[model samples]
Target chain A: MNATIKTLGLAAAVTLAAAPAMAQEKLKVGLLLTLSGPSAVLGQHARDGFQLAMKDLGGKLGGRDVEVIVVDDELKPDVAVTKVKGLIERDKVDFVVGPIFSNVAVATHKPIVDSKTFYISVNAGPSNLAGKSCNPYFFATSYQNDQNHEVLGKVAQDRGYKKVYLLAPNYQAGKDALAGFKRHYKGEIVEESYTPLNTLDFQSELAKIASMQPDAIFTFMPGGMGVNLVKQYRAAGLADRIPFLSAFTVDETNLPAQQDAAIGMLSGSNWAPNMDTPENKKFVAAFEAAYNTVPASYAMHSYDAALLIDAALKATGGMTDNKEALRAAIQKAEFKSLRGDFKFGANGFPIQDFYLVKAVKRPDGKLQTEIAEKVFDNYTDAYAKECAPTN
Target chain B: MTATLFFVQALNGLQFGLILFLIAAGLTLVFGVMDFINLAHGVQYMVGAYLVAAFSAWTGSFGWALLLALPSALVFGLLLEVLIFRHLYDRDHLDQVLATFGVILFLNQGVKFVWGAAPLSVSVPELLSGSVEIANGLLYPVYRLAIIAAGLLIAALLYVLVNHTRVGMLVRAGASNASMVSALGVNIQRLFMVVFGFGAMLAGFAGAMVAPILSVEPGMGDNILILAFVVIVIGGIGSIRGAFLAALLIGLVDTVGRSFAPNLLRLVLDPAAASQTGRAIAPMLIYIFMAAVLFFRPSGLFPVKR
Candidate 1:
């Protein structure tokens, strides 16, 4: 009996000691996202969506146990670089996924890609990354930065809007947004106002818009800025007079805060909560059940990123060491994306359909964006032409 | 058309300035009287916003929410004073800044823990829900106008209280010389508590009032706090009148500069280049104004008569 007790104690000790070793063998992933301030909701959704996918996969990726390290970028590019270096060197993650904002992505891109680890950008597909800077190791499950904005540009043209006022934060993504809109829009631009980021007050901008009396107002204010602009726009009674066409200005992420003010607001997007696809329906239901909030494109794209990784790993027979094989496997991964008929173009950015979505309060009282109509089919980014095919 | 646009922008500036004054008033008072750098004062404003948002959601009425939020904010301010800030009074300004900055980080996380990271909204009250024609063909939001009116009323009340009341006199004296006031046998501790709590309430009030218009989210107070500091610095460290005037000036400069900078720059540069440079430079105008003020008057426009 004494010998049996000793043997049992030894077994327990060995298991306890080997647990961390087991963890080391698990697939390591670094999740870097804007997890602070007003934009934190976007990151939270992304994180939750990724987590939900992991849970659904029985806590494994590519038939291997997985470990996720989440770090907040704090919406600071400098901070993101410092933290991402730590993720690469110290944690030594196999894959680095992240960054809801373009600036942070730009900041952390070179560091991660220069290293051996693969980068799967769940959000923030900066135009430059889609063009000449595209790398085989970097895959963007999300659509390119300008595609959604391009949807509204085309919509405005089709609707016969003669003049539109454009407003966006003065940044790379904002400039990209306006440029993308102008690509499809042949209308006269009454004015282009690029406010500083985190500009909550838009009364002056609205006043300018009112004076200009444009046929439509197009903007790209995301997160809290979106909530404020939508509310202020309604309160100023401009919503009744002028049509508001935007991308990321009135979406699921900020719609809860925007509520009635954002209702009827038209926005350009790749996918909505109401997109009718089996994969999307499953994603939305699972995401809603898990997080109790409607999953935005940020969440949807991140979820797709995980599936992409899994599919690639499966194709490689769970091998992560062979760089060329893994790269080709990821490129050719036949993962069913939440957004219908998704595929990567030459630039490693997704070739996907774009939609015109509207903010509406569902019968269940949740405010979410619903697909109003398809704007573009099998849309590939214009920047792809600038990129040499990795294959 | 330009004149009309200018007039409308000036009104927007006035409204924006008044809101800034509401926040800067308390901040100036606390800094002046206690000689304490409360970096957490901005978080206190954030708390007020959150409190009102929560209460408004519960009560289903804006009036009720504001009524409940004000006292809760006062109590929350007093609680922070009693708990954390009470010990830091004797510390050097650097220590106080570090300690209060820690408080800001803590409270920001705390609010997120309590109220999730998602932004919350408080609907505009029915009384101030729509826009009214403020000029021929120019419409201004009624809620914004109400904020201006409330700000003006509070400014008037503050001017009277600081100039006329006994507590106000004590506060001014404390700001000028705390040890001297203490030597005069007044309970300086109680006076500090009162000033600190009152200042917190004022900041809370500012946050609650703007909660209807702004998204109540974590770190919402951070940007405005920087603006408030600029207001106090330009207005003078401890002068209520100075803060008020400085707040208005900063607001007008910010609003008007943002509105007309591109047009002004268009005189010297192409339209695209002008708009780009103007947007880049507009946000810097307040800092420039502050630098000019400090250059001309090192102790601020109306320093305490020490």
Candidate 2:
């Protein structure tokens, strides 16, 4: 058994060594995301979007033949840590692009950054990374975690809502969502409730909402939880009585399942499929043609991440050896973002526009979010000032 | 909380409990009679939801979908039993666990391959689509109430089926001692198959009933599976009566505790601290209840007499 194992290991080593030498020098990218379980749709879209961008570039990034390794995080932090270590140590990827959810980002952030590898986030921009713990190697192609929720908070305040009930899955992101909402909406918070992550049933919580009859209800449920909550909220007849304001809960990832139940629901977002720009229009059309499903912000952000990498490589002339040069090029963000006017804050988070998007059923009978109104222009995150100049 | 809110919460608890009971009933019976730990039982529930969703889209009527889904779920359960599970019945518990876990992974991926990862929308039938006012200023969804009604009716049916039938007598006997039943000339293997399939259908039925309300997606059964296991363990591994009572206790504790935990804590702790601590503790309350139960009655509240 020992002799056979040794033989197999030698054969594997030869295979790994021969392929890269035979081919042109390839840029290896580790694409880590939650690709299983209920939230798998989010990661699937992100993967497809990144793949679409790669296809648009003739399967190359910055004129270099690229090899992408996709791994499923399974939305478990421990599982993510192990998988990311393999990508770093065994694969020796030049860049690590990943992580749909914030918890996984928090788990893999240190390991990827400490290895002197650039970590480009497609989604999941947790607040801590935008502040004291920010690393030069880490760059978020997505908006800061609090920005989308802050848009909803501002909308609620502008609409003159006196009291709003808030709900979110109890986790780091969930807490951040409520805090972001509270930052702008100074009206009385009628009540704040946090359900455990992935909770499907909201009957008890719905009962509480019915009794309170607050001016509006704000929530931050995503993926399957969002689908269930929207359907349940509609069934409970609260959608008609209370204004529903949210972020991520009523977006494209869930709109397909939500259908009529989610129509006219307002959500805060950085981009939507219906945003009117030639580049966005072309990207959205191509994405739908390839994937046959409307692209969510998750997909949009990931596509942008791929473009960001390509742009950085172009500036560096595809040379990945000089870490400082690559980091500087990525910080410049020299790409036409699908969302329009994208640039990085000092902390490597996006300084971009946010919108109060509303869900609508299109003429094609597909449900998606459309930009209802622009809420912020060139918005900078609250935590950016806390990021010290280290690089 | 006000009286009306308390009453509404209690109703929600009952509804949630009934769903838990439906899933736990099958799990307890299989564990008790076969002495086989089938971790893939949750996948059976997921399959049921998927089956109902598909039928609903194909037939364009939820009622017809449900009617067709029941028999289909039965066939699917029996198919799994024949294809994979029956062979493991005589194996040790650890081997059975590992094999069944593989089945769960395979089936979860299989469903995704067939249905795609995005949740399929299953609409509530028009007959039960709206909300009804239960009390002054209190409104509840008619569909949820329908679920509660259906759950109760099935519980009553299960009670009669398990207590009065000759097959049930053999099942109880088999749970006590399978070798004695075999020695008495009963085809104990066939009896095990029957018990296993019936339990799977019960779980599937629970899944079908909630398809309209829940996200009919892959791995949807995982969390509920944990809760169902807690119900069976707390109630007693084999006792139908114990499972029913314990399921209700767990459901109420989980639902009511989630809402009231912070309020109760606020009487002592500061509001922020109470809310944070409450959110942390509420999800764990059921396990705490299970632990407390095991401490008092290790074999469960209604352990089968060996």
Candidate 3:
């Protein structure tokens, strides 16, 4: 029995020694998203975009076999932390992505930073992390939370609106949005009302807005709340009388539900469906073919994140074990992004052009955003100045 | 202008209260009669909205969708009672809660699978598409007013069914003493099933009615479910009249508080502090009211003599 055991052990050692020479090392990517609750649609879009990018590369990153593990955070911060911990400890993922909401990002990113794993945020880019709290290993493929709203603020100011009523849900992101709007908007603020998140009815608030008689109404209600508010605003005969200006509220996800009510509504975003670019044209076509719906801004961000990772891997010649090479490659930002002129700013957030878009009826009678004008060129977040330069 | 704003807000409060009553009436009935704590009650409301949305698209008429969805919702509720809820009747409250909670998780995901995760919109029927002039220069959606009228009509119907009918007498007796009613040779299980099915249908009706005005998405019923519980507790569980008064009172307090709390607090506190506190306290007003009511009346405002 001793002779047989010695022979088996010798054989195992020989096979293990020869394994690395024959096959490349596997790259594990962990995706943490709010996949099962109220914000599930956002997560679904992110997942689809990531998968599409993988498919575009023929299911390999940097010529190395890849394994992706997706987890649902359920939109809870604590749940996000737990899932992220599991990703690092149990799954042993080298790279991490996702968490669509800012609050979830705040909770999940600290552990990733401590563990020294590469984190690419697909949706949320909170200001706290972009400024003094910035980490060397963190990058945001999406815009900083305030950048899109800043564009809307500038547009509203340029339109000569003297008095604007601001509305947002009561939360961290809501406060950030209002602050961003106030930065560039040089107008008299009529009223700033913070309604409870996920509120279905807005009649009372609409009544107040009507009484105040602001020149325009600016809001930041996202998801289903956005749909309800737009529908009710039109139903109340307020949409026509008062020009509506919003950010992240009248996007493709909720535009179908808003229908004619959304038409003529103005919003500012980094990427729209009708942007005239070859890369964007290819992305929108492939996404619609795969998902049978127009891809939203969240999906574009996730697609960009995957492409960014692929570019870094290729630049390093698939040497993921070399941390310095990988980080330098990502910072180079050489990938062709659907959003034109994409690059990483000092804060590791996107420096991309933002546009003023209006909801218009298409030839096919579908509601879609039509880019009216470029609002910002190679814009960086306010917190970029606070980030210390490492290079 | 202030007076006009006040009048409009009051009307909004009344409309919201009527919707709350519709949901709480059924919940209180099921809780009061069977002693079964079914946490999945909210999912029934969710199912109702999904069914209406699906049917409206297929049939291309809101009226047809309503006509078809109600019967389908009734059948669905009856099926649920027979398949899952019936086995849970004899179990303890904790077991019932666990089992029903499992149902909620299952059905919430089930709806998402059937109808994708995106929120669906049901267009208002052409007959009710226009706005009505409530006061001079004040236009309100006719659909919202229609919701109020329908809710009130259902409340009247429910009152008559519970107070002035044979089945209602059985329900009352069953609520008071289930074992004694069983001793009198009444099929108590059948009575329980009837109450459960009818209660579910009522909740479904409320969901279908609101689908056009509100976004019909998964988990939409969860928040309103808590508010309905507060309404039932404040009204005294098992009393339709209590549910009515408590629902309206809650609706008015919540609407008025949210609208004017900041202005009222500005009298004493700085504007910034007042607005912050007002937003923080608005969502809690119903719960505070519930605690106060329960403090004075432990059994609820109109607890039946069970």
Candidate 4:
């Protein structure tokens, strides 16, 4: 009887000793992004920004070592779902980040939410999640899909433009963008056209736009499509005559390829390479030194996501498995964002400032987007009001 | 105003069609003579563009880049032929397709590995930097005009090479009946290599020429490849003349259709519905045309064997 009691006492001691070691196990983060196809640059920039944040954090988040598993979705929603499932069921990640395009986000978000894994979207904040379907486990460090377009709409309204032509790729996000622009701008839209997603040539559309002769044109063609449109627009001599307004079209990733063609083009975003904040300045310098290129808005969002993650981790002492503690910590959002004065709305999307930027040539002969004016101050997405507080 | 717009639209259509022809010419010839389906042919166009971008950056002269890229593209084509394609010639169509699709996957990733994923731009040569007044009060880029001119020139050259020369006779005979050509004292393997190499160079030349206007990136040829297949199908397999006619037809239908479809539909449907349906129908116009042609003729408009 005394020997049995002593053995039980020894087993309890061993269990107590192993508990601390088990708590110190590395936290896993699954990064799902479209790292291939035409839009690979977007994913690459996002990854670079996220990795930069990790580097700055001394390769640790929340005082705990992190293991990041990056997977390419190839910009396909089905593939994204498969990879996200792998990340959840196979890798057993504590948190997930990214899937840059909106369609992929919509398809993959449900599983993450259902599985109760913490999700901080680096890019692609779809409206569906911001409204009735808002989940407590999901937070977006990026603006909702329509927020950037809403900034452009406000800019057009402020500028007193009487007639504007809107063009975008005919996809879910494109339609949402057009609707978002229409929501705020009360001007007479001369025409709105949605071209095929894979369209490389825009001559016919350009000719049509020229004939209509709107005061300004707003378009949302991302990736190589944007480069082709902007170049072709300049080649057609339309850029000199019409003001080109865009969202998510002109940025650091594509500006080098566009060169002089993107000059004088106006765009709206939440961040610019030249934003004058200490955190942004430091980020820009470190990013340029590391990648030899200016980080774009996508990168800025991703970097902010990493900082948010770090802040939450620190708040909870890296207790990622303690769901309630991690949730409360994430809700605090106490990170210095590259975008100044960042905070999340009730729907978990960013309520941040949006800036009107113009693509300009630097003295060094490199293309850079410079912030011209603030378009929105402390703006929350339109869908945020529709979201019932789940937290 | 309408007349000038129409003229420019027509010019745009013609330019697009000619570019399609340049890509389709090589593809159709290879398919016709070799009886092989080379899905990787599109990647050859992509390689051509990348080669021009890299060569232009290295040489700092577009003219020299073009002059140098042609032979390199030809050699690359021959190399691919000897390395992988030669082994697949005796295989069935499904096997050839599977093998070439693998090549497409390999080359697309290979380009990305070497060049990085960012889109690269090739500046227009100073000689072709500006627009020309192609019509009264109408201006078009000189580079586009140059592409159209170059494509036509190649078409004429191809006509001469395929219909006039001794080697051309062998190719035509081989296309009609490979066994008969092999029996007529012709080295069929050598003929196949020459045709394959020349076809690749043609596709590569198209890519290099358009590199300045298009964003040169990996997988760029994938879309154009599908369009080339449509062109060959409509023009009748293996017929250069057929490919040319079919390419122009598809291009005109696509450009003009996209530009006017909404307005035309607005006549019947509500404005909102018209635009939505128009946007949806524009891309399908050529495919619809291809289907209709195939339905009526059952062997395309100009099947070469017939």
Candidate 5:
């Protein structure tokens, strides 16, 4: 009898030893993105947007103190998995939201899914994950990678732009953007160009595209590269010679440097500063009032990401541990999106409006996204049809 | 392609090459002399551009902004050195890589935190604003040609300093053997600071010069950092002359290859295949060149003593 009691005691001790800390005083969150290098500008904006929402939440979420553990993936997939493991296993985060680059997300998705930790991506909706690879465990708070480009493609096609030259960085997101453009654009594509992922120089690509003498050039260079391309295009005197249609190319972040170059360029965007909505206006005013800066695209989506997470937690009645419940809550898209009427598709992407945004200098000497054009009032991504949710 | 179009494209290549050289000169120096790989070096360039934009606005003169931004860049470099880089001088390359990488994170965000993420423009001085008509029907922006001239002039100045000055002699000595330089009573530590500071300012100068043409924004330097790395690697980490040549080569290759790749492929394959292959190979061309150079000339085209 004494031995039996001792054995049971030993078993109990072993269980306690193996188990994770059960204090549960805080709900740890993991944020992974390219916090350094060229993409840092967007990453910084994202970080700000995420923190702004947390501040709005009075420094807590779901009645638990929030501890956000941010990691820099250095824009590498391997680094993403390593940092994510640290967050999930070591930090023991309750939920994970992050990884700006699509390739990084693709690399880290499997391990995260297997761990059963909810992944709410702030940006990058690679089509495969939105379709066949769709998992109940994953949700995207930002536009799917294809939606922006697809919208641009449709608009370009409608405009009867022939001999379009395609340009994007040589990376997974770039490839996806090209594929997305191809899905909607059926015009005679004169040529396609892929520059280095971190390349700032676009002169050669510019010259080559000019050589083709295309009616228009379509580009997907975001952040600084977008700015570089536009500025150089204007300097090269190609702006007047050709129509430069792009996806996520010129927005508030890039439009200022572009000046005259950005004036007539067309793009696809989910949120623009000029988007007229009470929610958008509130977001813009609050952001400008708070930071004294115009809101970039990153700020818009990342704010939505936080709100989406908050909505999921509230919908689940503040129960953070139930994965299925949280997934279902996110799928329902119960949050008040700054972008207006935001809902999640079966693929876990937004089923919201995709505006055909034009870059125009605001009367105040700063550039702004005016809704001079729009491709779809309510856009459904091309890959949504392919997502058989039930599997 | 028309001759005029090709000539314009070649000029574009030259302009791109010059910008690459400006960045690579500073980057390669740090790598070659200190054997330190700074990932945050790009942030230095970003700082340059921002300083130029803000100072130009504040001072209301491009000349003053240029003058003010140079010292600020040097001061910024010195601050970074004391704060983070000093500890990294003797650390392993991996740790140095990570820490400098951290500085990039802090500064990129810091810039956004202070200046915001929006792109800011530094207008080209009124003197150099318009375009210049070249050989045949090509009107090129005058600022671009000026950038090429500035880069070449800097290259010559760098060569003269390294090959013909007292500080240059000491720099060469330190790069060759820190132990010997120390034995010879040279202040190795101070020398390092000067090199680091000078390199930082040069990168900043590049940023300032380019800012008028390109938009100044956070994370502006990252792509140039990669190209600079490629130039240093291809040219030899410690050889400034090699950096000059390799910068031009990479700039021309990247620009020319990207332009001609599809057309070149069209000749060898069908139009569809050409476009696909060209798109696939264009970005890889420089990387392929780097790999080839590394394989053939392990230490680069010109390996410094260190």
Candidate 6:
């Protein structure tokens, strides 16, 4: 019986080694996003962008078929953990991706990592994982949680915008954003407001912010709440009086709903729709042509995530069934990134650029993003250095 | 502290409170009278919103859409009562809560299946499209004032029904002691149907009225329902009067706290800490108010005997 079991194990090893030769088969990638209740817009955007990337790659990845298994995290970390485990255990996906909120991402990271399944985060970069918990299996395609806000803090400090009013939805992300600003900015803060996580009414809060007459208003409302705040902010007529700076709220998803009201709003991000690179330009045009809508930042990062996976797949010579070999191949910088050449940091996050984009009304009459300033070029996140994984 | 800003926020609070009352009045009545804890009440609001959105689009008139939606919302609520809620009355609170929670899960998902996950908003008619000046340079959305006015009118009408009418008397009687009313030969099953149906329409009105302003998406009612439960507990379950006052108080406290709390705290604490503290505490103001009320008045401020 021992000899028979040993022979079966040896046969499995042989099959793993031979997986590279039979690499042209379909590769399944698990896509987990917050697909319901307040975060649907984000999930929908991610799905659209991921699907678009598949289309751009000639509807295939790494000379093989790519199948995406999408699941809704529902913005709950425990639920996200369960859903991710289901994806790995039941669906048996090759790799798990996504979770736009940092809390959910962090919650599910342990199970995926313990299982030795590769994970590529599209959004929600928690500081701890970026620092201490950083494993080779975990990679962040999106900016770290504090990185974008840190840039906004610098801008606020550089411009000497004292008495800034900060607004965010009441959640871990909101707390992190406010903390992030404090870590960088030394100026006097006039007010800070945390509305309910899914609050649609922002008039009262806006009234409060306007009353303060802060030098600038920094906010982090995402999804439908962002749309509500932007529209009501205009209705309250706070434009030009108090400059609005935000993250996640002023993007393509809410832009259509906000229309002209979104014009002149400033936001910071790692990527924008009009990023003016051959890859990004082609991606934008193709996405617009296919979906009849402009891709938001959520979509862009998710597309980059898929392409990153695809690049790793190709570099591994299409061998994904051989998990160890595929992991090693993907670890190297093989993806042609839309945002220039940036390799993964030791922590699995890419060394990437950041930009401060202005919400501009293009001459063609659509609300568009234009680069107001470049925050960083091929910059590493603050937490990356702490992530020294002992081999 | 400008008058315009103050007036707008005060009124915004008032509007917010009034809208909540419409929702809470029904919820509190159900809890107080039936002793059945229902989590699916929020879906009724969603149904009303979706109904108005669809019917308005079909008829091209907000008035007719609302008129048609009221009956539909009531019918849906009555159907839910018959299918699920009636059985829960004799069961334990835990069982009732779990069963109703399941209904919430099914209905929330069902709404998504029927209406799709995308948010739907109602269009304000041409006449009520812009703001009207309630005070100098204090232009309140005419529609909002109309909401406040309509809500108060409903509150008054509800008061009249609960106090002046024969059915309202029985409703009050049933709320205090359901067994007594049953012993008196009232058709208790039909009464359950009426109260549940009416309660749903009230929640539905809140949804339809606010749909033009708020996005009508799935589970929108759930959050407000939590606040409404707090209201019912504070005002005295089964007491429309209690719901009104508690709703207004909570509305004022939440709105005013959110507007003024940070600035108020900045006077004492460091600016950043104050801001952080303010945002964290703002949403809790109502629940705090509720807890205080519960602490002092265990049965609620207007508790019916049952």
Q: After superposition, how far is residue B114 of candidate 3 from its true place, in Å?
A: 1.7
- Residue A71, model 3: lDDT of 93
The TM-score values for the models, in the order shown, are 0.92, 0.92, 0.94, 0.95, 0.77, 0.86
**Worst lDDT 10-window in candidate 4 chain B:** B131-140
- lDDT per residue for candidate 5 within B1-306, as digits (tens), equals 557667777787777787778778878878777878899989999999999999999998888999999999999999998888988989899999999999988888888788765577788887888887664334578988888888889888988999999999888877677778888898888988999999999999999998887778777777678889999899988788888889888877877777778778888899888877887787788999999999999999988865
The alpha-carbon deviation from the true structure for residue A232 of candidate 5, after best TM-score superposition, in angstroms, is 1.5
Say which docking band candidate 2 falls in: medium
Please write out the lDDT profile of model 6 over residues B1-306, one tens digit for every residue. Answer: 567777778888999999989988888888877888888787788788888888898999999998999998998888888888888899999999899888878888887787666666567665776766554333456777788999999999999999999999999998899989999999987887888999999988888988777767778877887888888888988888999998998889888877777778989999778877887887788888778889999988877764
What lDDT tens digits, residue by residue, belong to model 3 across residues B113-134?
Answer: 9888889999989999899766
The window of 10 residues in a row where model 5 chain A has the poorest summed lDDT is: A17-26
**Which digits, one per residue and each the tens of the lDDT, describe model 1 over residues A1-391?**
3433454566667797754454336789999998887688899988988998888778878877888999999999999999999999999999999989888988888999899689999888888899988888888988788899999999999999999999999877788889999999998998988898888899999889888889999999988899999999988888978999999889888988899998898999888988888878988998998878889888988888889889998887677888989988888899888888888887788888999998899999989999899999999999999898752
Can you list each candidate's DockQ? Answer: 0.65, 0.56, 0.64, 0.67, 0.36, 0.35
- DockQ score, prediction 3: 0.64
Candidate 1: lDDT of A369?
A: 90
Comparing 1 with 4 on DockQ, the higher-scoring candidate is 4
How much is the lDDT of residue B173 in candidate 6?
94
User: What's chain A's TM-score in each predicted model?
Assistant: 0.92, 0.93, 0.93, 0.93, 0.88, 0.90
When 3 and 6 are scored with lDDT, the better candidate is 3
What is candidate 3's lDDT per residue for A139-187, written digit by digit as tens?
Answer: 9999889988998899989989999999999987888899999999999
lDDT for each residue of candidate 4 in A1-391, tens digit (9 for 90 to 100):
3433454566667797665555456789999888997789999999999999999989988877889999999989999999999999999999999979888888988999889898888888888889888888889888898888887898899899999999999887888888888888999998889888868889888888888888899998888889999999998888998889988888898898999999989988888888899989999889989998888888888888889999997777666667978887888769898888888777888789998999999887878899999988998888887898853
Residues B1-306 of candidate 1: C-alpha lDDT, one tens digit per residue: 789899889999999999899889889988988888898989989999999999999999999999999999999999999999999999999999999999998998999999988889999999888788865656888888899999999999988998999998999999999999999999999999998888888889999999999999998998899999999999999899999999999999999999999999999999989987998899999999999999999989899888
Better of 2 and 6 by TM-score: 2
Q: Assess candidate 2 and give its lDDT.
A: 0.90
In the range A230-259, model 6's lDDT, one tens digit per residue, is 766765667657888888778887776566
Off by over 4 Å in 4: A1-23, B133-138
